[model samples]
Target: MKWLKKSVLLIAVFAVGVVSGSMIWTSSANNTGLVDPNRPGSVNDPLITKSYVDQAVAGQVKTELEKQLQGQLEQLDKMLADKQKEMDDKIVQFQKQLDALISKAGGMTVVELQPNQTMYADPGATFIVRNGTTIAVSTDANGIPDVTGGKDLMDGTPIELNHMLIFPREGRGIKSTHSSTVFVMVTGGYTVMNPDGTIAASSSMDNSDQNETAE
Candidate 1:
C-alpha cells in the first residue's frame, strides 16, 4: 500500500510540473517577441489594426464603385445611341415629307405678257388670268376648258379675271388682248412668245396638272 501511494504522488507531481512548464514556456515565448507582427492572421498574432481593415474595405469599395460606374457608362452610351438613331429617323421622315410637299406644289410660276404677247402651253397646263384682258387661242372649235364656269371657252373669248382655266390638249394657248400688260399664273408647261413669235421665256413641267376638275 505504501509503494502504491508513492507512485500515485509521483504521477501527481509529474502532471503539475508539465502544466507549469507549458505555461512558463508560453509566457517566455510571448515576452521574447515570438509572435510575428508581419503575420496578423496567425493564431499567435491575431490582432488586426484599424488602418489595415480600413485599407481592405476601401479597396473593395473602390472595386465595386468602378464596376458600377462602368455599367452606368455602358448604359448611358446605349441610351445615347438609341436617341441618336431615333432623331436621325425623324429627320429622314421630315425630309421626305418636305420633298413630297414641294413636288405636289405643281411648280407654279407667274408670267407677265405685254400687249399682243401670246402664251402657248402643253397638255394639262393650268392658267389663272389675273390682270388685263386675255383671249383664248385654239386650232379647232374646242377651246380652253373653263373649270370654274364648267364649259369650253371659245377662241377669242375674253378670260375672266381670277378664273382658273385648263388646256386639255397641246397647241392651245392664250394671248394678251389688252393695251396694258397682262399678269397670269401658269402651272405645268408653257412658252411665252412676243408679237413676232419669238420665244421670250419658256418652262416645262414633268407632271400633269392635278387640279383639272370643274367646281
Candidate 2:
C-alpha cells in the first residue's frame, strides 16, 4: 500500500510540473504584444522588452506622419494653382483699366489684343470665303479646332461640314484625286457635274444634304 501511494504521488507531481510550466510560458509570450520582440516567440524563453514595443510604435507613427505630410503637400499645390488663377484675373483687370484710363485722357489707346476679339496671324492659314457656299472646317475636342484652321477660321469654333455645303446627301466620290483636293460635297447624293453644270452621276437621294467629311 505504501508503494502504491508513492507511485500515485509521483504521477501527481509530474502533472503539476507540466501545468506550471505552461502557465509561465503563456504569460511571457502573450505580453510581447509587439511583433514578438525579445524574440518572444522563441521556443526556449518568451517575453519582450519596452524597447521593442517603442521601436515598433515609432515605425508605425513615422508611416502615418509621412502620409499626412504627402496629403498636405497635395493640398498646397492646389492652393497655389487657385492663387495663380486669381492673380491672372487681377492682371487682366488692370490691363483693361489702363486701356480705359488712356482713352479717357485723350491719348490714342492702341489696343493690340482685346478680350472679346482674337486675331488670326498664322502665315499658313488660307481664307477662302465663298459668297454662296457654306464653310467646312476641321474641329477639336468639343468641336473646336485643335490646330489653327486656315487664316480664315474664326477664333470661336468650327462649323461641322456635314451637309450639302460639304457633303453629298447620300453618295461617295473620288474624295480628291489630287494630293489633297477638297471635294465639294453636293447634296441629293454625288452628281458628277458636266462642264455645263448638268448632273453626270446621280446618287438618287430624294434631296437631303448629308455629306462625307475630311479626316
Candidate 3:
C-alpha cells in the first residue's frame, strides 16, 4: 500500500511541472521573433512593415510639392512686376512726345508770343490776338533766350516752357532768331533756313509742291 501512494504523488508532481513550463513558454511568445506568421497581429500586421514606410514617403513627397509650388508663385510675382514697369515706361514716353508736339507751335513774323501764353503748334505759330496783333515773344529781361515766352503768351505757365517749333500759315518756324539754332526748310525753290536763315538740307524736287523742311 505504501508503494502505491508514492507512485501517485510522483505523477501529480510531474503534472504540475508540465503546467508551469507551458505558462512560461506562453509569456515569452509575445516577442517579435516568437510571432506566428499564420496569425495576424492585434495592433499591426507583423509580417509587413510597408505601411509605415509608405506613410513616411507620403509626408516627404507632400513637403517637396509645397516647396515647388512656392517657388513657382515667387517667379510669377517677379514677372508681373517686370511687365508693369515696362508698361509704365511706355506711358511716360508717350506723354513726353505729346508735350513736345504741343510746344512746337509757331506764329507769324509780324506777331509775337507774349509772356504767360498757352502755346500750341500750328501751320504758323499763331496765338490769341491782342488789339488785332499777337503778343510779342521776347527774350528774357537780361537777354537770355525766352523759349517759354511763346507758351506764356498763349496762356501757359512759364514753368512748362520747353518747346522747339512754331507753326505758320505756310511753314513751321523756330521760336526765335536770337539763338544760333537753324531750321532748314525746303521752300518754293530750294531748302530754306527757318530761324537763322540758311540752306542746310536738300531733297529731290518732284510734282509735290508742298513745302518740305528738314531739321
Q: Per-residue lDDT tens digits of candidate 2, residues 134-196?
A: 222233222222233322232232333322122211221221122222222222222333234
Candidate 3 per-residue C-alpha lDDT over 112-190 given as tens digits, one digit per residue, 9 for 90 to 100 = 2222222223333322221211222333222112243533222212222233233333332223222222122212222
Model 2, residue 110: C-alpha shift (Å): 3.4
TM-score of each: 0.45, 0.33, 0.30
List the candidates ranked by TM-score, beginning with the highest. Answer: 1, 2, 3
Off by over 4 Å in 1: 1-106, 204-215
* Top lDDT model: 1
Name the runs in model 2 displaced over 4 angstroms.
Answer: 1-45, 113-215
Q: Of the pair 2 and 3, which is ahead by TM-score?
A: 2
lDDT-sorted candidate list, best first: 1, 3, 2
As a whole number from 0 to 100, the lDDT of residue 94 in candidate 1 is: 72
